[model samples]
Each structure stands twice: as C-alpha cells, then as structure tokens.
Target: MLYTAYRKYITFFLILFIRLAAFSQGNAGGNTVQTVEIEPGKSINFKATSTPGSAYQWFKDGNPISGATSPTLNVSEPGEYKVLAQNNLNCTSEISDGFIVTVKTSVLVKQANLSVEKKSETKATSINDPYEYLITVKNSGPDPATEVIIKDILPEGLIFKNMTMALQGKFDYNAAARTLTWTIDKLNSADMSELRFVTEAVNPGSVVNTATVSATEADPDLSDNSSTDTKSITDLTIPNVFTPNGDGVNDRFEIKNLEFYKENEISIINRWGNSVYEKKDYQNLWDGTGLDEGTYFFVLKVKNATGTWQAYKGYITLLRSKTAQ
Candidate 1:
C-alpha cells in the first residue's frame, strides 16, 4: 500500500508540472512577429503563443481592451498598440512592446521648377512687368501616378490671367477641359527638364500664383516640391471702344485700349480727301465742334498691327445739332 501511494503522488506531481509549464509558456509566447504594416484600411497581425486556456487582451492606448481577445487589430491613425496574455490559472504576462500605427497623406508634389525671364533684361522684352515665369513638373519615381493634379494657388481667388505650357513645340489646348495631359513613359531618371509652362497672377496682390503638383501613387507621400518663386508678366489689353464724343463718355477718338500697342497713329480727313488733322500716338477723340458740318470723310491710316499701312476710310456726318452752337 505505501509503495502504491508513493507512485500515485509522483504521477500527480508530474501532471501538475506539465500543466504549469504549459501555462507559463502561453500558446504564442516566444514566437516574434516583426514588420507590421498599418495602412489606412488595413490591419496587422501579431502572432503570439500562450496556453490554450489563456485569455488575450489587446490595447490601443494604456486602457484595457474589451473584445480585443485576438492578436490582430486594424488601426487608422498614429498611436501605440500592444497585447497582453492571462492564463486561466491566474498567471499574467507582461504587455508586448508597443507598435506604432501611422497614416500618411496619399498624394505628393514633385520636381516643380520656377523660371523667370526679365523684360528690359537686355534681350528680355523691355517693360515694367520685366519678368516672365514658367512652371514644369514630372512624376520621376518608381510608382505609377494617378489622379495627377496641378493647382495654381493665387491669392484673393485670382485665377491665372495668362498661362501656358511648353511641349517640344506646343500642344493643342482644350480650354473647356482645364486639363493638360500626355502619355509619358515611366519618368525614372528621365527628368522632364524639357517641359515648360507659364501662368500669371491676376491683380496686384501680396502673393503671386504659386504652383503645387501632385498625383495618386503607391508612395504618394514621396512626391514633393522641387522649387518655388514669384515672377511677373505683361498685364495689358486694348480698351473696347474709343469715344469721339465731347462729353467724355467716349470722348477720345484715339485707339481704344491700345496701351499695349508700341506703335500707333490717327488722322482726320476732310470731305475732299484733304488731310485736315493728324496726330501720332494720339489717345483722344475729335469733338467735330469748332469745324463745319456736312459729310466729312475721316481716314484711319496707321502702320497696323501687321506692320502694314492700312487706311480705314469712313464718313463722319456732323449734323449741326446739340449743345455746341
């Protein structure tokens, strides 16, 4: 009977020892999982081992997790993640080291350059708005970029009054689309140095129209600014109409909105094709008051925009009427 009791005791002890060992190890205790990637809509798995009867708890911050009984969890923002294991026998394990979960902006801007050409800069066009600017960009990376977008941010809701892009020659513009695109091979190291573009700010605001470019890609965050600057362009246009009325409503019989025209002239002729009045670079009108009434044929003679002298002959009928007695 004594020998039998001793054997029974040894057997019981062995069983207890095995149970303890298993509990101490926990099912996935020692195995380590590295390189957990936490993307926007993705989850990461941490394979840990512990006893089959052990309880699992996962934590986002320092607080205890409720239903996080699993070893994996999907995270979206930047924060700490950890897991803890507890055995049924009241044994506990240390919290796993915290892993960082981070989310990044998908799009990136890249290879942006700003070039300025000064007018009056010798052979650089000569004027107050002496500088001309151009913008260029590329997707010089391993990933294919999609949703490629470019924005010219100007202050006060000002749009690009004058803007252009440069191809080897020039690409046709679809003004309705507001989109400029071309099928380009992978931009690897093939910097789009040959690419050039132009745009001007609208008003005299504190800032110029700055450009920011981006696209959707595998690693969009890698896209970023190449360079930035502020430059000016010729902001000019011809007026709509030239008033020859004396009341100043349209009093000037000069070239309407001709400020941009470097060379100009105006001439008033008589009824018999005889030159009565002439003025070069004239910016005003002829009231036809101090003169006699009847059919006076006026000729607009100028070395027109095409560098050719053209005569626009028309009759200015002065009907002896109105305030000028």
Candidate 2:
C-alpha cells in the first residue's frame, strides 16, 4: 500500500509540473504593433519582445518571410508585417498584430519662373497712352503643381485697362490697391502659361510692375519666383521760344502730345504772379497775340481717370517777329 501511494504522489507531481511549464511558455507577453513610414531607398526595423530560449519567425501578409527567423525584421515595402514567437517546448503564442510600413514619395517644386515684357503704341510713351504687358509663367516640376497662383502689383502713375490669359484661370483686379491676381488649375511638369494685360500711363515718370508666382508645393528654389519690369513716360516738352506772328509755322506755343491729356489745367503767370492765361482744357492753341513780348511761367496739372492729379512747372518765352503786319 505504501509503494502504491508513493507512485501516485510522484505521478501527481509530474502532471502539475507539466501543466505549469506549458502555461509559462504560452503566457509569454506579446509585442504592441505599430505603423512606420520611411523615405525612398530606406528601410524600417521592427523588433519583437525578446524571450530567453525563444525563437522567432517573421511573416508578411500571412506568409512566412524566408530566412527571417530572428527577433528583428527589416522591411522596406508598404505592407502588413507580423511575427510568431515560440519557446523550446514548442509552445507557440499567437502571431503579433500586423505592423504596417509605408513608403513615402518625395515631391517638391522643381522650378518657378516669372517673366514680363512691355509693348507700347509709340517708341516713347506719353501720358494717357496704353502700354501692353506680357507675363509668362513656367513650372519645371517633377511632380504636378496644384492651385498655381500669380500676383502682380501694379505701380502708381498708371491705370489698369484690361487683362487676358491664354490658359484657363480666374482673374481679379483691385482698383483701390492696383493689384492683379490670376489663379490657375493644376500645372503639370514642364508646363507653361501666358498672361497679358494693358495699362495706361497717367503721369510722366518711371512706372515699375512687379509680379510673383507660386503653387501648393515645397518651393525649393524661390529666386526665380518674382520678376520686375519698368516703363518710362516721356517728359512733356513745351517750345521755350515761339514767334506767334501768324506765319502758321511758329504761330503757336504748342505742347507736344497735349491732346492725350484730356483732364488737364494750364495757367500762365507773369513776373508778378499775375495770371495771364488760364484754361481748364488747354488744346495746345496758345498763340501769343494779346500778351506782349515777355517772359512767363506756366503751370500744368493733369488728372487721371482715378481722380489723381500731377503737376508740372516751367518757364516760357513769347516773342513777336518783325515781319508781323
């Protein structure tokens, strides 16, 4: 009876030991899966929880990855990754959750260039004369550029006339700030667009137009994004000396290109500041008939369509010829 009881006790202890060993191997903690992103030509490392005397087998998309039996796996592609853990006793744990690795593409703005040119009706521009501006934009990108926009800041001493574009886009102009805007659709790689507008020089000076181009991407180089062009308005020349003797050759003190300035005021002042001749609209028909041969100061002020005025002052000489009847 004693021998039988001892054998039963040994058998019970052996069963308990076997059950505990199985439980310990199966109860191994699992690793928390995570998602990772890597750049092109790069790889990401995934490591599972290390357990002594345990072996690992990495799988991808439910298929075992050959020779990936270590506790760590290096992958580059974008797909689901998982690993199985097993102990010496052949007790295996459930495969860990999938850790996704995504490969990211690099997209950036390769190039952005803005160019402008001016075309005028005459070689020398005068006040109130229209000048045509040609604006061109190009994108030499390796990727598509979306929502491309171009902005132009129209300078003072000029008025906006009209705008046109060769490409499909939306145009907007602000008279108060004298700004023009164009918004375009997606611009593919090596694509180009053209825009044109007309403006009139209202005053005599240098007028500068500045423009810029941009898109919804990383503009690595911004040096070519903006461009500037300038146009100069010729100075109004008045005959310093005119012999208004009715000869029809020098019979009038004519101001060249005065007809272009419709909204203008002219005044002739004597040496003592006494106004001699004054007119709201001077038609370049000033003939020295009533005034004597003397020196005079002339003041000319012109207003633009936006109701802005510019003034010019200079000296004039009126003389009578001896051949006058």
Candidate 3:
C-alpha cells in the first residue's frame, strides 16, 4: 500500500510539471512587426509571432478594423496598424507593437492625375450668339480613380442653354448657382470623358469658364485639377464710314458678327431726317443706291429668340468719289 501511494504522488507531480511547461510556453514572447513602406496602390502584409491558441484583432491608427482576425494583415493605406491577440484560455496578451506603413509616391507606376480642360467650338462670340463648350476630363494614371466628380463654373457673361455627354453618369446644372456638376462612378487609367454644353454669349467682354475635377483616391499631382478657357466678346461692330463709289473696297455699310443674329431691323436716315432706306434681316446688301452721299444717321434693332432686343444709334459717313462707276 505504501509503494502504491508513492507511485500515485509521483504521477501527479509529473502531470503538474508538464502542464506548467505548456502554459509558460504559451505566453512566452510578444509579437514583433517590422515597419514597411510601399508605393501607392500597393499593399504590405504584416506577420506576427506570439503565444499559441491566441485570437487576433487588427487595428488601424488605433481603430479596430472589423473582420480582421488573422495572424497576417494586408494594409494599403499609410498609417499605424497593430493586432491584439487573446488565447482560448481567457488570458489576453498586450497589444503588439504597431506596424507603421508609409505609402509613398510611385516612380515607376505614375500616380493618378485627373485633369479637366475646356474648349469652345467658336473661337470668338458675340452677344445673343449661341455656342458650344466642350469640357474634357483626362486621367493620366497607373491607378484608377473612383467616385470622380467634376464641377464646371460658368461665367456671368453667358447664359446656359443645354448639356450633353456620352458617359453614363449623373449630370446636373444649377442655374441659380451657374454651376454644372457631373458625378462618375469610376474612371479607368488613360480614360477620358467628354461633355458638351451650349451657352449664349450674353453681355459683351471676355467670357471665362473653368472646370474642376476630383476623385476618391489620392492624386499625386493636383496642378491639373482645374482648367480654364477664355472667349473674346463683341456686342456689335459697325463701320463708321464707307465709300460706296463702286470700287468694291468700301462699298457697303456692314456690321461684323451680325450673321449670328437672325432677326434684325435696319433703318437709314439722311441728314434732313428723311428715311432713306430700311430693311429687315439686312444682308450687308446696301450699296447706297439712289441715296445722296453724305453723313447719315442709322438705327439698328437686333432681336434674339431669347426674347431680347437691343437698339443701336450711330452716325455713318457715305462718301461718293467724283468719278463714279
């Protein structure tokens, strides 16, 4: 009986020692993570060495990342990432040292650059003239851009007419704000989106339009985000003098940029206030036929489909040389 009791005690002590050794090994060391740096759109995987039967919860910048319960972590954004491991025995280990990831600009893979540019179909415009503006967005990228948005601010000297585009996206114009906005879900690398809008040149001067572009991803270059276009304006250009001597050089009194206006009423009055000539839609066809050559007063009434009419009165000189054709 004494021999059997001693044997039982030895067995118990041996089991205790084994259990203690396993427990000590379970919590022996802390996790070690090396810092990493990667180019944009690149990911870095983190590895850890720690106790057995441990659970892991990953964090980014001290915020717990949901559904991240693995020994390895894949990180793309630049920030401080860490993991918390807890064993099944209910003993929690200290949070592992963080992995500081730096997302540097890519040299081989050119970073995304979203740019916008505007162009007018007509080089110059005049009041009451309708013209179209082509706004283009080009993406110079080794990476794609998502949630792209474009804002086009129209100048005050223009009246918005209409807009059109081929890309599948939501586009809107706020007349009160004089702003046009476009929202695209995604823009792939080397892709371009062209949108066109028509506007009437309202008041004269220099009409300037600007377009701005942005994306959800980080853009290495922002200098191309915005672009501008300027169009010269002339309300009306009428010659003050003309020599209608049949020389065909200065034979007719014509108005520049008058073809843009379809509706017009022109009247010519002599020095004695006599109505010498009058016509509708004057085609620059006046050759001073049967009219005395001298200084004359003229009145021009121009009308546009937009329900706008402007009147211009000025002095015009009609000189006829002594040698007539």
Candidate 4:
C-alpha cells in the first residue's frame, strides 16, 4: 500500500509540472494585442518592454524575423508581430502580445503636371493708365498637388497697384522688388485658379511679364510651366488746331501730354512743302514766329525709352489775329 501511494504522488507532481511549463510559455508579459494602421510610404514602431541584460527576438506571423534581436522593431509591411525576451541566464520569458500592422492603399498618384498662363486685355497702354493681368494656374495631373507656389516679377514700366478678390489661396506683392507671389495649399486634378494683378503704366516701352508655377509634386512638362504677356506703352496726343495769337489761351503750339518726353523734334512746313520752322528739343514755345500762318503741316518725332524714334505726321491749323503786331 505504501509503494502504490508514493507512485500516485509522483504521477500527480509530473502532471502539475507539465501544466506549469505550458502556462509560462504562453503567458503575455502584461501586454495586449494591438491593431496599428498606417498609410503607404509610412512606417510604425513596435516596442517591447525591456529587462536588464536581456536579448529580444521578434516574430511576424509565427515566423522569426532575421536580425530582429532588438527591443524595438520598425515595421513597414502588414503583419502580425510578437516578441520574446531572454535574460542573461538564457531563461526565456513569455511571448508578448501580438501587434497587427495594416497598410492603407494609396489613392493618388505621386506625380502631377502643372502649368501657368499670364495674359492682359490691354495689349497697348498709355502712361498713367491702369491695367490688369490675369494669371491662371492649372493642374493637369494624375494626382493632387500641394503647396503650389506661383511667382511673377513685374517688368520695368509697370507699377503694381492691387489685386482683385482671389478665388483660391492668397497673394502678396512687393512694390520695392516688383514681385507678385501666390500660394495655394492644395490643387486637385483638373483644377485651375486665377489671380488678377492690377497695375499702372509708369514708363514707355514693350513690357514682357512672365509668371511661373511649381508644386510639391513633380511636373512632367516644364514647357507650359511659365507664361508670358507682352504689352506696349505709349502716351502722346497731338492737337489739330492751335491759336498762336498770344491771348494766354491756346497761345502757343502746345501738344497734350508731350512734356513726358524729354527728347523730341518738331518741324513745320507750308502748303508748298517749304520748311517754315524746325527745332530740336521743342519746348512748346513755338509761336509760328516770322510767318503768317493759316494752315500748315507738322512732323513730330519723339524718342522712346528704347532710344527708338517714333514719328507723327499731321496737319496743324495755326490761327493768328489779323491785327496782331
């Protein structure tokens, strides 16, 4: 009876030991399974609790990951992960809880094509005239563009005044630098935006204004990325009739808006095509002196900012009182 009782006790202890060993291997070290979601081109970190002088091994879907012996794992793929720690004595701890990392599919393309167009209704403008330039930016893309930047540096002879109400994004103009900058947070595919730049003509010449566009995405076509608009500036008005009778009103052969040009020449001729008077740098002081004028022809030539002379030929009727000395 004593031998049988001892054998029964040994059998009970063996069963208990087997259960304990299984429990230790499957127990989670104060960790719970967590689901992590990440987008494409992104990564997530899986960190395990650390113990002094301990080595770690990480597993993905029950398979041991090569070289994954650190306390932390940077995961970029979709998988179920778990980690186990082994102390200096080579005593392995329980497997930690699983981490399920899932990746989200990308919905947009990586590259986008952008273009810009600049235009003005006033192709020909005069000095002190207010005009507007419309700058349009388009996204012909397979994806949305972010952080769109548009830059337009105004050429000389154009003065920035202000911009009209913008449809998308914001704009700023630096008068000192003559630069206009527009910024948009996002521009979707097949989308377009516009900016109206109001300005004034301050000088004379052919003005070429260009606008360029860029974005965070890569543009396939750079040829259409920039657009240019050209405008001509001229300010002069000739009078058909003038009274040189010294009446303090229309007393001299004065031309409207002629003082703006410093370099000019004027020549007057009679009905017989004989030169009656000629002067360089004419100051509107000619009173048709030494000639009784009824009607005459005049040729006026003025030099522009480009040093090109522009000529104006027309008939001028000079009226002098019959009793004038």
As for candidate 3, its clashing pairs are: none
Best by lDDT: 4
- List candidate 2 segments past 4 Å from native: 1-43, 49-57, 61-63, 78-130, 137-150, 161-173, 181-196, 202-205, 213-225, 233-325
TM-scores for every candidate against the unseen true structure: 0.29, 0.43, 0.44, 0.43
Candidate 3, residues 163-214, lDDT tens digits: the string is 7554656889999998899888888899988888788887876788788999
Best by TM-score: 3
- Candidate 2 scores a C-alpha RMSD against the true structure in Å of 13.7
State candidate 1's TM-score.
0.29
Better of 2 and 3 by lDDT: 3
Superposing all C-alpha atoms, what RMSD in Å does each candidate have to the true structure?
Answer: 17.7, 13.7, 15.7, 13.5
Q: Whole-model Cα lDDT per candidate?
A: 0.44, 0.70, 0.74, 0.77
Query: Which consecutive 10 residues in model 3 have the weakest lDDT in total?
Result: 19-28
Span of 10 residues, lowest total lDDT, candidate 2: 18-27
